[model samples]
Target chain A: MKNFIFQNPTKLVFGKGQIEKLSELIPLDVNLLITYGGGSVTKNGVYDQVKKALKGRSYTEFWGIEPNPRVETLRRAIALGKVKEINYILAVGGGSVLDGTKLIAAGIVSDKDAWEIVLSGVAENQIPFASVMTVPATGSEMNGGAVITREETHEKFSFGGDYPQFSILDPEVTYSLSDHQIACGLADAYTHVLEQYMTTTGQSRIMDRWAEGLLLSIIEIAPKIKESPNDYELMADYMLSATLALNDFIRMGISQDWATHQIGHELTALHGITHGHSLAIVMPGTLRELKVQKHDKLLQYGERIFNITEGTEEVRVNKAIEKTEEFYRSLGLTTRLSEENVGEDTIETIARRFNDRGVAYGENRNVTGDVAREILRKCI
Target chain B: MKNFIFQNPTKLVFGKGQIEKLSELIPLDVNLLITYGGGSVTKNGVYDQVKKALKGRSYTEFWGIEPNPRVETLRRAIALGKVKEINYILAVGGGSVLDGTKLIAAGIVSDKDAWEIVLSGVAENQIPFASVMTVPATGSEMNGGAVITREETHEKFSFGGDYPQFSILDPEVTYSLSDHQIACGLADAYTHVLEQYMTTTGQSRIMDRWAEGLLLSIIEIAPKIKESPNDYELMADYMLSATLALNDFIRMGISQDWATHQIGHELTALHGITHGHSLAIVMPGTLRELKVQKHDKLLQYGERIFNITEGTEEVRVNKAIEKTEEFYRSLGLTTRLSEENVGEDTIETIARRFNDRGVAYGENRNVTGDVAREILRKCI
Candidate 1:
């Protein structure tokens, strides 16, 4: 196993009515700014609950942090934060709001432009922030990484910074989510585990088992959740699984392949596909194109996750890739580029963009522009 | 699932040559106290590594914290800490050294005696402490709980407080461990997962799967470790398993049964068994006595961990319990009180102690003194 250091300090306040913890979770003395997305929280009663919990506490509010959290939008939040002298932030909606608020927190404390911070790839400092996490996708609640898009440039990039001081995850809030949102969330979480798990085997046995466990739980709960969306236990599993998936818990002392996510980000940026849906389409393609490189792990994943043990090595690897795309399709998502109307022009654009930047992604750093084009061509 | 709040802030620095990070991990200004066990580190070269890492730093050293970590030995360390006004502590040996340092951390900051703090069941305040963990047992590196013995009264109790600031776990340091220590460490890690897992089913599917993952990893690594004790990957798995088994990561929003640990602590206090060995002997007894109450979970454990699916419910439960005992025995530890030469007198003493304390344990709070007696008899 490779050497690693791990530490996550986000206090997870989870379960029913945990939103009531907002008053205590956020500090009493700091100048607070509560950030939110478009008005879904109002319809879902999350806004009322958050307001009631923080009753009599003075704070500013910023709304309309979009899904692929645009940098153009977050710059305004940063300006508002600077004017208000906000020392702490409370993100009240989903992952987008929290991801935007991360940039806002960084912007409030530094003279760097919000887009510059994203380009820097790390925020040197940020004002403290907590969240009333209403969405389970992206795992922005507990992790330090955030992906923000530049609308003008049609680009999306992630940056690392301080984790939330606390995150209140009341699974009951998820009962108001749309089916499409739920599907995307499940796909995002499952792909998060695959990014950390579908690498070289034998690096860390515990990490492998843990990644598989999360995959198994996501797979088991995905169908049951469709049947019973309001079931407290099922949503709790989904919420917790998403947070644990990307919170550095399963990637300790191990090689990780986020090539699928890198390609998916381009799809989201260029064509405005939902983040998780893009992954559902692109992950299978990456797996199929890189099957030989990931052969051993694919066999293990096939056997452990899909019970595909009665096949030859090559057949098992193919079966594993097929089963992965099928799992995403089972989530009511389209697992092909053509299904989303993304064609060769967009694929070539992404490949040329990668070539222009001279970037090679994945565990072995071999997924160059040509490899990405091949992966996308397979998806088409 | 239950409402819960979870947070762990200990930074785990793992892999070879991590002890060199001590200078950067600890603060430069605090008055530091370095704590140790009975000089195992001296013979193992860990002592030289620690000293070399902190060469220019001024610190005090306290030695000779024995197994089970008695309050008697810790009081002197506490007194020394008070005299030196030590505000930071670094434990450089195994769990015993860290456990004793936990108490000393509490005692130095409070007016109450060390034993009083232990009996209080919670330390309200403690000076900051970190560890260079040399043993792969007890999980004191990442958790806030510590069990300390009162040698004068033959009593053992646990208390909870602040977690370590950081812990350095270099699996290479485990190469010097004796075979018996390795066996006991493996058993301790395995039993730790069982205490959290072998309760009611369906509280949280993710928690159950994660706990099972740890159990499977431990089971797979135990025999291989016996043959290749010096293997880095195997030892890394073992070390990481011990830390994760009790690190509050798997017990979120779930019922936990520490009854085996409760009885095992008594065995340690009375008969002077090693902590892990005591658990090995008492755990199977607890499972056998409480089989009816833990029926569903026992069946699940049997099916998942040992693949004992070819039997009736009762037969499967019995086989699970038997397999648990056999696993411990295969670790080269005796799993029965009779094999260890303890008899009815010691059993009665432990039962009377529990009865006098008026404590009922287990998930249902029904492991009373009578149940304790029955469990002990099963062990016999």
Candidate 2:
């Protein structure tokens, strides 16, 4: 196992009607900014609940943080926060709102441009932020990562900042989500586990089991959630799984492969695919292209997750990949590039972007630009 | 899932050679009190590492916190801390040392006797403390629960206190543990997961899977660790599993049954049985007596952990109980009172203790004194 330091201090307030505790969770004296995305919280009654909870608490509100939350929108929130002297941010919608709020938190404390902070790859100083998480994808409620899109350049990049001081996850609030959003959330959570788990084997047995446990739970709940998205228990599991998936709990002392996410983010940037849908399409390609490199772990994952034990090595690996794609499809997601009308031109553009950045990803750092292109072609 | 709010803020610096980082982890402005066990660290070279790390930094050392840390010994440390006005504590030994430090942390701040704080069951204020953990048992490194025994009264009780600021867990430090200690540590970790998991079946699928994940990891590692106790990877898994088992990660929004632990603590208090050994003996008995109430979970645990699927309902439950006892015996701990040579008297004492407390445990709130007697009879 490798040397690592792990600490996540996000207080998870979870279950039914948890948003009402928001007023008590946040301190009384801070100048607060409540940030949101494009009005879904309003339709879903989350905004009303939050407002009622904070009835007389003084705060400023900023709306219009978009899906794949863009810096262009977040700059406005930061400007509002600066003028209001906001010391605390309460993001009240999906992952996008929280992602944008992370930037505003950092922006309020520093003179750095919001995009510059993304480019710098780390934000050390940030005003405190909490979340009333209405969406279960991206794990922005509990993790330090935020992927911000630059609309003009068609680029998306992530920066590390501070975890939310608290996140209120009322699963009942997810009852009104669209089927597509639910599908994407499940896919994102499942892929998050795979990215952390499908690396080298035998680094840490507990981490391996934990990563597999989340995979098994996601796989088991994906179909059940489709049957009953409003089932409080099912959505509760989904919400908690997403937060735990990428919150640095499963990656300790272990190698991780985020290559699929890097490629998927490009698909979202260039072609405007939903973030989680892009992963559903790209992950199978990653597994197939890198099969030999990931052979042993694939065999283990195949046996443990899919019960694919009664087959030859090649057959089991194929069955594992097939089962993965099936799981995403079972979530009502399109698991192919052609289905989304993405092809060689966009794939080449992503390759160029990766090449221009001079970066390699994955556990062994071998998923270079050309390698990413090969993986994408397999998706096509 | 149930309504829950959860947070743990202990920073874990883990791997080989992590103890050297402690000097930098603890601030130097406060009067520091370093606590230890009876000099096992001195022979194991952990003492030299800690001393070398803290060279040129002045601190008082408090030694001789025995296993199942007694409040009597801790009172002296608390009195010393009061005299010195020690503002920070660095517990530099095993769980017992840290457990005692937790009480001293609370005891130094108030005029109340240490035993009074233990009986109150919660310490609202405590000075900051951290640990350089040398044992892989009890999970005191990452959690706020502490179990302290009072030697004079032969009483053991637990209380909620503050978590450590940081903990340095170096797997290499576990090389010198006695075989009995290792056996108990494995059993402790395994039972910790069971206490959280062997309750209602469908409270949370993710929590069940995570609890099952820890159980499987412990079962797989226990025998291998017996053969090669110093293997870095195995010890690292063992260490990480112990911390994760009780760190509030698996118990979110779920009911927990610590009835076995409640009974086991009494056996440890009365008969001086090792903490883990007592659990190994009591847990199977708890399962056998409560199999009807815990039938579904026992069946699930049977199928998942031991693969005991080829039997009728009653047969499967009985086999599950048998397999649990077998696993503990395989850990080199006695599974029955007969094996430990403390049969009826110890059982009677434990039951009386529970009866005197007028409390019930388990998911059904029915593991009362009479039920405990039945459980104890099963052990005998």
Candidate 3:
């Protein structure tokens, strides 16, 4: 196990009507800016609940932060935040809004351009930001990292900043979510755990079990959630699992492979695929392509997660990868690139992008530009 | 799932050589008081490492906080802290020292006596405290709860207070632990998970998995530690698991049954048995006595932890209880009252103590004085 420091101070206010805590959760004296994505919160009654909670509190509202939160859009939010002299940020919608608000929070307090912060891979200073987290994807509510896309260059990147002061996760708010959103959310969460896991085995036994426990719970609950979306317990598990996945809880003293996510972000940037669905497509390919490197963990994953113990080592690994793709397809997502009409040209573009950035991904840092092409081709 | 507000701000500096980070972790300007258990750290080299790190820092030293940390010992530390106007506490030895320091932190600030603070069940105000934990039991390093024994009354009670500002857990420090201490530590860590779990099923699937994950890691590591106690990775897992087991990460939305712990505390208070060994003796009896109430979770625990299949429902539950006792005994700890030479008189005394307090334990709050007697009788 590696020497590490772990601290996460985000107070998670979870369960039914937790948004009612919004008034007490956010300080009344701070100049607050509430950020949102589209108008889904309005239709879902989340907006009304939040407004009711923050009844007399004065706040500016910024809407239309798109999925795969765009930097171009966040720049305007930052400008508005600067002009309004906003001291606090409350992201009131899904992960995308929260992700954008992270950048806005950083940009408002620093002279650095919002895009510059993304490029630097860290937010120097961030105004305290939190979330009424409606979607269970990205884990932006509890974690310090945010992935923001630059629309002009078709690039998406993550930057580190302050974790939310608090996150209000009322699972009932997810009842009105599109089935596809739920599917993608589950996929994103599952992939997040896999990325943290699926590296070297035995680095930390507790982390492995936690990652497995999380995955097992996710896999068990995913189908049931489709059958019963409003089931409070299942969505509660989903929301909590997603937060725990990337919030440095399960990754303690272990290496992580975000290669799948790094590749998935390119898909989202270039072709505008939903973040989680892109992961659903890419993760199986990353597993299949990197089978030999991840052989032992694949066998364990196969047995523990997929119950694929009755096979040869090679067969079990292949079966694990296949079952993962099957799991994604079971979530109503296509697991192949061609099925989504994403072709070699886009794959080559992503490869060139990795090459241009001189970035190597994954736990071993071996997933260079050419290696990414191979993984993407496996998806094809 | 229950509505919950979760936040633990204790920074965990984990792995080898973490004690070197003490100077940086603790605020240098504050008046610091370093507390310790009976000199185990002196021989283990933990005290030297701490002193070396804190060479330039001015601090007062308080020693001899014995096992099950007594309010009597803590009062002296508290008095010393008050005299020195100590605003920061760094517990240098095991959980007892840390637990004692927790009380000292509370007592130094309040006009009330140390025992009065313990009797209050919650410490209203506490000076900041941190730990260089040498023991892998109790989990006092990462959590706000501390179990302190009242020497005068032979009463053991847990009180809530401020979490450690930071905890340095270097598994290397655990190498000097005696085999018995290791046994008790493993037992303590395992029972901690069971108290949080072993309640009703399906409160939160993720939490259950994480709890199970922690239990499985401990079970797998216990025997190996007996063989190779100094293995860095195994001890690291042990240290990490013990902290994670009781740190509110697993009990988020679930009802918890600490009936075993409640009974175990009585055993410790009356008999002076090691904390973890007391749990080992009490837990199986708690399971056997409350089998009907905890049937579903017992079955799940049996199947998941011990793989106790191929039996009737009653047989499986009985086997599960037996296996739990067996696991404790495997750790070289006596799991029965007669084996430890305690008789009915002690049991009755504990029962009377619970009766006097008018307290009920367990998830459903049904473990009254008479119920505790039944559980203790099962242990006999």
Candidate 4:
């Protein structure tokens, strides 16, 4: 176990109709800037619910925060926030809106550009933000991480900062989600757990079990959620699992391998692939490429999560990787680069980007540009 | 899942040498009250460490807070705090000392008697308090709940409100704990999870998985810890499991069965059994009495934690109960009322007390006094 400081102050207002409590949760005096993504909240009735909750409360609204949360749009939100003197941001859509709002929160308090804040890799001066989370992927509702895409250079990067002061997670909102969105959300959550897990074993047993637990829940709920998308209980479980997956709860005193996510983000940046779908495509490849590095933990994960205990070591590892991609497929996601029309050129471009950035990822920091190319080739 | 709003604001500074961080963690401007148990900390070097950390900080030291944390001793601490006009408290011992300090934190601000505050079941007003936790049992370091015994009446009760602002969990401090203390701590943590879990099945899958994760970790670590009592990683797992067990992190949007704890507290108040040991003795009994109500969860727990998949439903449930008692015995705690020399007379007293108070517990709220008697008889 490693020396660490852990504190997450996000007040999770969960379950049915929790958005109604939003008016009471936020303080009465702050100048509010409610941010949203492209119009899904409107179709889903989340916009109406949020408005009903904040009835008579004066606030500025910013829409058109895109998926993957580009800084190009967030800079505009920040500029508007500064003009409105917005002291509090209320993000009212999916992870993208909340992730973009995180930058706006930081940008409102500093003279730095929103993209500069994202590139700086840490934003220490953030105005407080809360969320009415309509999507369950990315865990932006509870965690301090935000992955922002740069439109100019076609790059995506993450910065860490303040968590939401509160997040209203009404699982009922998930009933209106597309099957593809639900699939991506489940994949995002599963990969989130795997990113934190799939490392060296025995660092923290509780963390391992917790990561396994989230994976099992995601796996179990995926098929059922497909059959009954409006199932309140199933959606609630999915929503909560996503928030718990990357909220620093399961990574306590443990090593994490975000190599798959780093590769996946590149896929999203270069191709405009959905963030979670890119992870589904890349994770199996990373696992196969880095199998020896993550051998023991993979074996344990195979046994615990997929019940793959009756095989030789290599057979079990291969089966575990197969089962992982199968689970993503089970969620209706395309788990291969070719299925998404991504090919050698894009893979080489991602490798070039990594090499240019001099980036090395994974638990041991050995996943260099060449290693990434091999992983991507395996996916192809 | 149930409608729920959850937030815990306690900052945990964990791992080796975190006590030295107290000076920076606590504000120097506030009047401070440093609380302690008897002289064990003095021998363990935790005292010198805390003293060294707060070398220049002017504070009042209140010592002799015994196990089970009697209100009798805490009243004196409260009076002293009032005299010194202490607005901040830094409890530098185990759960009992910190639990007692929770009351003192409440008492120093309110005009009401400390006992009255405990009886009120909620302390709305409390001066800020934090802890340098020396023991891992009871989880008072990171939670709002505090159990305080009223020694004069041989009665024990709990109150809720105001989590510690921060807690320093230096696992190195646990090395000095007695083997018996470690046994009891492990038992306490195990039962804490079962209380949150072992209730209705499927209320929250993540919560159940987290509870099961803690239980599995405790069961696996108990033997290894007996062999290497001071192993940093093992003890860190133990210390962390204890805090996570009762920190409201599990039980989110779920019903809980604290009937074991409710019954266990009676054993503590009556016979002066250590808090955790009492739970070890009573929990299996609670399971047997309530097995019909907790059937599904018990089976799931059996399969997950103990791997009782080879048996019939009844056989698995019984095996699960037997294995739970066995785990407690593995921790070197007495698991039967007969082993502890408490019998029907004490059971009757607890039943009478519960009946007189018109109290019931468990997820279904049906573990009334008579049911408690039946549960206690099972223990006998």
Candidate 5:
């Protein structure tokens, strides 16, 4: 167990019709900017509910933040926010909007360019922001990290900032989501827990159990959610699981491996794959390539999450990796690179990027550029 | 799932040698009052570490807050705090001391009488406070709820107040705890999870899995801890389990049953038994008496925690209850009132107390005075 400090102050207002809390959750006197992505909230009734709640309250709206939350798009939002003297940000769509808004919030109050903030990898000052979270992926609603992309350069990077002042998560808003979005969301959430859990075994027993619990939950609810997407109980579990996965709740005093996510981001950046589906493809590859290094935890994860106890050590590890890929495929996603039309060029590009950055990731800091290339080739 | 607003802002500084952070964690400008229990910290070297960290800081120490944390002792601390014009509190001992300091924090700032505040059952305003937690029980470190007793009247009650500003939990500090204290702490953490769980079935599967994860972790670690109490990893898990059990993380949008805790409080108040040990005695009894109402959850608990899947529903439920009692006994705590030298007179007294208050507890509010009496008799 490592010495660490943990604090998250995002007030989660969850359940049906919780968007109405927006009026009370935000201060009325603050000049507010409600941010959105491609106007999905307008179709889903979330915008109407938010408008109804903020009736007569003075606020501006910033729309058309893209799926990957591009830096160029957020620069315009920041300029609009600066011109409007916006003091608070309310992100009204999915993770992309919230992720963009986080950058916009920081850029509004700082002289630093939005891209500079992303390059620095952290934002120290930000206008207070809250969310009417319409998606259960990325966990941007409760966490302090945001991934922003540069369309021109084909790069994506995450920056840390203040958490939302509050997040209203009404699960019913997810009823209209496309099947691919739902599949990507589930994969993202499951991979989030795995990123934090599949590292250094025996650090903390309770943390291991908790991480396994979230993984098991995502696995159990994934199929049931496909059968009945609007089932209140099923979506409720999914919403809760997504938030819990990245909310600093399960990673206490433990080593974590985000190598899969680091690789997945490159896939999203270079080839425009959806964030969660990229993880669905890359996580199995990372596991298969690193199975020996993560042997014990993979065995425990296999037994606890997949009931794969009747196998030799190597067999169990292989089965765990196979079951992981199968789980993602079960969610209507392809876990192989070639199936997605991605090839060696993108892999080499990502490897060159890691090499240029002179960086290593994962718990042991051994997932270097060459290692990432190996994992991607395994995926191919 | 229910509509809920969740926020806890306590900064948890966890792991090895975290107490050294106190010098930087607490602000030097505040008038700080350091509170403690009956000098166990002095013997354990925690007091010296705290004093060394706070050498140049202006602070005063208040000692002798006993087990269960009586209002009588708290009033003295409150009076002293008022005299010192203390605006910050740092509780340096176990949960008892921290619990008493919670009242002191509320009382020093309020015009209401100390007992009146307790009778009101909630403190809306409190001076900022933090803790250097030396015990792995009660979870007062990360939550806003505190259980305080009135020795004069033999009454115990809980009140809601400000969460700690920060808490430092160094697992090494728990190495000196007695076998009995360790047993009681483990029991307290386990029952805390059950109180939040063991209620309505299928409301939230993620929450259920999280609760079960804590239960399984405790069950798996309890015996290992008995053998190696000073093992850093085991104690880290134990400490984290206690904090997470009651930290509002697992109870989101879920029904909770604290009937066992309600009855157990009376046992602590009347018989002077340790609070957690009392719960260990009474919880199995509560399960036995309310098995019909909690049948589904009991079966799930049995299957998940104890693996009691080879029986009929009724048989499985009974076995779960029996296994719960057996686990407590294995922790070297008595699971029956008679074994602890209490009898029918005490049970009737508790029943009368509940009846006088006209209070009902549990998820369904059915654990009335008579039900409590029945539960206590079962414990006997």
Candidate 6:
């Protein structure tokens, strides 16, 4: 196992009516800024709950943080935070809003531009921030990483920063989510585990089992959630699984392959696909393209997660990749580029972008521009 | 699932050569007190490493915190800390030394005596403390709970307090551990997971899977570790599993049955058994006695961990309990009170103590003194 240092200090306030904890979670003296996305919280009663919880508390509000949280949008929140002298932020929406708030928190305290912070790949300093996490897809509630898009440049990049001081995850709020949102969330979480797990085997047995455990849980709940999305227990599993998936819990002392996420980010940046849906489309392709490199781990994953133990090694790897795409399809996501109307032009652009940056991705750092193009071509 | 608020802020610095990070991990400007056990570290070269890492830094050293960590020994450390005005503590031994330091940290800051703080069941305030953990069991390095024994009274009790600021866990330290110590550590970790997991089923699927994940990892590594005790990867798995097993990572929003631990502590206090060995002897008995309450979970554990399927419910439950005892025995620890030479008098003493204390344990709060007696009888 490789050497690693791990620490996550996010206080997770989870379960029913945890939203009421907002008043106490955030400190009383700080000048607060509550950030939100486009008005879903209003329809879902989350807004009312949050307001009632912090009754008589004075705070500035910043709304309109969009999906795939753009740096263009977050600059405005940072400006508003600067004017309000907001020392702390409470993000009250989905991953995008929280991701945007992360940038705002950094931008508020620094002279660097919001986009410049994203480009820097690490936020040196940030105002304190917490969240009333209404969505579970990106795991922004607990992790320090945030992906921000530059709309004009069609670029999406992630930056690491301070974790939330606290996150209130009331899974009951998810009862109002659309089926498509739920599907995308499940896909995102599954792909998150795969990113950490589908690497070289024998690094750490506990990590492998944990990554597989989350995969098994996500696979089991994806179907049941479709039938009973309002079931408190099912949604709780989904919410917790998403948070634990990418919160640095399962990647301890292990090699990780995030090539699929890098490709998926391009899909989201160029074609405006949902982050998780893009992963559902691209992850299978990456697996197929890099099957030989990931062969042993794939065989183990196939046997444990997909129960594909009866086949030959080559056949089992293929079956595992097929089963992965099928799992996404089972969640009502289209797992092909053509199905989403994303063609060769977009794929070539992503390849050229990778080439321009002179970068290689994945566990072994071999997924260069040509490899990316090949992977995308397979998806097509 | 239950409503819960969870947070752990201990930064885990793991892998080889991590002890050198002490200079950077601990602050420069503090009166630091370094605590130690009965000089195992001195023979193991850990003492030399720690001394080299903190060279040119002046600090007080308190030695001779024995196994199970007594309040008597800790009071001397506390008095020394108070005299030196120590604000920071770096415990450089196993769990017992760290556990003792936790109390000393609390006692130095409060007017109450160390034993009073232990009986209070919670330490309201404690000076900051970190650890260079040399043992793989107890998980005191990463958790907020500590078990301290009162040698004079033959009493053992636990208290909740602040987590370590950081913990350096280099699995290479395990190379110096005796075979019996390794066996006890493995059994301790395995039982820790069961205490959290072998309760109600369906409280949280992710929690169950994660718990099972740890269990499976421990089981798979136990025998391999016995053969290859010096293997870095196997020992790393063992070390990491022990930390993760009790670090509040698995018990989120779930009921836990610590009845085995409660009963095991009595065995330790009365007969002077090692903490982990006592658990090995008591855990299977707890399972056998409470199998009816833990029916579904036992069956699930049976199927998942031991693959004990194809039987009636009672048969499966019995097989699971038997397999649990067998696992402990395979670790080279005795799983019966009689094997340890304890008999009816000790059982009655434990029962009388529990009855006098008016304490009922386990998930349902029904493991009263009578139930404790029955469980002890099963062990016999």
Q: List TM-score per model, in order.
A: 1.00, 0.99, 0.99, 0.99, 0.99, 0.99
Model 2: CA > 4 A from native? none
DockQ of each: 0.92, 0.91, 0.92, 0.91, 0.87, 0.92
TM-score between model 6 and native: 0.99
Query: lDDT for each of the candidates?
Result: 0.95, 0.92, 0.92, 0.92, 0.92, 0.94
Q: Candidate 6, residues A138-188: lDDT per residue as tens digits?
A: 998999999999999999999999999999999999999999999999999
- Worst ten-residue run, lDDT, model 4 chain B? B199-208
Q: What is the DockQ of candidate 2?
A: 0.91
lDDT of 4 by residue, B1-380 (tens): 99998899999999898888999999979999999999799999999999999998799999999999999899899999999999999998999989999999999999999999999999999999999998998999889999999989999999999999999999999999999999999999989998999887878888988899999999999999999998999999999999999999998998887888999999999999999999999999999998988889889999988889986899999999999999999998888899889988999999999999997888788988999999999998
Give residue A335's error in model 6 in angstroms.
0.8
What candidate 3 gets wrong by more than 4 Å, as runs, is none
lDDT of 5 by residue, B247-268 (tens): 9989999889999998999989
Give every prediction's interface RMSD. Answer: 0.6, 0.7, 0.6, 0.6, 0.9, 0.6
Candidate 4 has a DockQ of 0.91
lDDT of 4 by residue, A94-181 (tens): 9999999999999999988788888899998999999999989989999999999998899999999999999999999999989999
**Predicted candidate 4: interface RMSD?**
0.6
- Which candidate number has the best DockQ? 1
Model 6 DockQ class: high
Please provide, for model 6 over B1-380, each residue's C-alpha lDDT reduced to its tens digit, 9 standing for 90 to 100.
Answer: 89999899999999999999999999999999999999999999999999999999999999999999999999999999999999999999989999999999999999998999999999999999999999999999999999999999999999999999999999999999999999999989999999999998989888898899999999999999989999999999999999999999999999998999999999999999999999999999898888889899999999999999887999999999999999999999988888989999999999999999998999999989899999999999
Q: Which candidate wins on lDDT?
A: 1
Candidate 1 clash figure, as a count:
0
By summed lDDT, the worst window of 10 consecutive residues in model 5 chain A runs over: A200-209
Cα lDDT, model 6, residue A23: 80
- Give model 3's DockQ, 2 decimals: 0.92
